[model samples]
Target: MNNWTRKHNKFSVQNRLTPTARELWQWLLDEMPEGSNEIIDLRDFNKWVKRTRGFPHDRKTVKSAAQQLLDKGVLTQAKSYTAYVWKWRLQPIRVLMPPPFRKPQKKLTFQSEIPNLDPSNPQPLKDEYLTTTTDLEDAESGEFEQKLQACRKAGIYYYPKDAQFMHGFSLQEVLKAIIYFLFNRDGVRHPEGWFKVCLEDNWAGKEKERHQLRVQWSTEGLFEAIRYCNQKMGMA
Candidate 1:
């Protein structure tokens, strides 16, 4: 039998392996050669389910089990077209070994006397930068009225200076940053390609993909890129 055939047959080895092992075997076969370390497209698994007879319900169950295996260091997920794909590591699974006991590293503690600020040379408080708009209605309302009426008196107004600091980046900039980090920095091309496909597919037009991208990029991508560039070029 070929590797795929052998793999498929392994699923039907009734009494040879435990129930959990059999389930895991089937799941791994669904992913094929990509089982442990390489990424496999989830859509492929969905298609496989449709093709197979007597498939398990709660389709997410397989995914959840795969995730559990991943967490246990038994599998790794790689980025595929608009989704995380599964890959199986080729390494032999070793039985859990007892952790060796060792002395904990001593924690270093230090205390410094607080420097007294000179009254004559007192530093001025830096102005807070407005990041997000709290309320459109309050913003349209006069500042004085907002302060008086709103419980959260911290009213919104456009701060051109602060806005300039976080210059509204174009979508190209976002895509470039994602590509540079995923491909250039991390040497992981899968995520970069996935993102490109996502944009091409207009996945953002659909709420699901768009929201996921926005959240990931806004929180992790932009933050990391800004920090990296700042550190490298000494620009705050």
Candidate 2:
């Protein structure tokens, strides 16, 4: 039983969402109870996607689509509701739209508003964030460097390929996550384990993002190919 309305197309146009993402948006709207303020678990949403749709979409895909929606301001994460750090998998997300009926609305408390938790979009960080874990060895004074050192000291094993994979995000973001967890900003009891999960999930999301970009790039080539074929046919 789908609760989607024709109005969903408005979201698709507004957000420029892909077909899959548009479908996922409708799915969320259908699953969410009207006038309820509960957080939705991403894992459950992922499972529903696999079962309902013929295509074999995994949880990571749902997560990226969810993040894309979040970025586009279609969805929202309740970072302040939880005592612990609010990474994607660590915490649930909620649809931002108000319920149909009049009900008591909960005030929002966001973790992104927190000091160290507030990192900018994934871009080149300023000079202060460029240092490697090795450079942090002697000084150990700066908070950013200390976090990188702590990740290494925590027995987290990162190899060359893993390092390359993480290169997509600014080193500053990684270090911030580590230190923020250490400070119990998210209130995670096992910071090390949760960080590891967040790292893997974040990397998977980045790879999916890369793949989507590549697909968009290929579309241009596809149009060029069609034009070339038509020109040759005209000549013949």
Candidate 3:
């Protein structure tokens, strides 16, 4: 959900990695939110690993694993301010769904249905959106329409261009951005104008309560769908 981070399929990225290197790479992915742009301090991670694994691995041991990931282009080292502290960023290679081979297949569709609100009896907002996926034009466009409808249902002013601009994020993330606007829209004269800025920066992912809501689909889910496509192609 982090703006700087992108969703990737863990299984796909785990391909062809050494056991130690794979473990370390998986740890980095699990330790941080998907697509997080924050720099990871390896010293702290190593300490945490020692506590969890019940064995103190030498600095060289962990560094060797990191080196493997670096060589494989799974991680990138950042310019660190101190020699003692090493900062690293996970950068998984982009994997695409292989094209259909034998025959044409149905398009993947993501379904979302917002509850029709009763104006006479106002109730507190809940995670009441009903969702189901089926065949559609594409996941992003279908999700955009669903999210747009949800915004209208919630009395939020969401524009088509705004939805199109934010099509890069998954359905759930886009919904979270909408929820973020609602939670923070108090005292603002123009909710629509403020929402544009929120979408640009993705303030929803930063909110603590944003994680509490049940999201319909995540960016990771989209990539997982791609993985499914790859599996169908016998390339996963």
Q: Which candidate leads the pack in lDDT?
A: 3
Compare candidates 2 and 3 on lDDT and give the better one: 3
Give the Cα lDDT of each candidate.
Answer: 0.39, 0.50, 0.55
Using TM-score as the yardstick, the better of models 1 and 3 is: 3
Cα TM-score per model: 0.25, 0.32, 0.32
lDDT of 3 by residue, 1-236 (tens): 12212123333234444434544655676666543445666676667655643444567766776777667666665556553355666664342223224433334354424466343332222222112212332454567788778777767655563333344445687678778777766765666545544654567665654655436667888899999998999963
Residue pairs of candidate 1 with colliding backbone atoms: 35-87, 35-88, 36-87, 36-88, 36-89, 37-87, 37-88, 37-89, 38-87, 40-86
A best-first ranking of the candidates according to their lDDT comes to 3, 2, 1
Task: Give the per-residue Cα lDDT of candidate 1 at 39.
Answer: 52
**Tens digit of per-residue lDDT, candidate 2, span 1-236:** 24543234434555666544555565666666533344666666556755643233555566566667667665554443332222222111224333335344344455556565434432323343445533653332244344445577754444322232232234576765555445543565544445644553564456568989787787779899899999999999
Candidate 1 per-residue lDDT, tens place, 24-81, comes to: 5445544454334655655555455445322332456546545555555445433434
Residue pairs with clashing backbones, model 2: 84-186, 84-187, 85-186
> lDDT at 20 for candidate 1?
31
Query: Local error of candidate 1 at 199, Å?
Result: 42
Model 2 gets an lDDT of: 0.50
| TM-score order of candidates, top first | 3, 2, 1
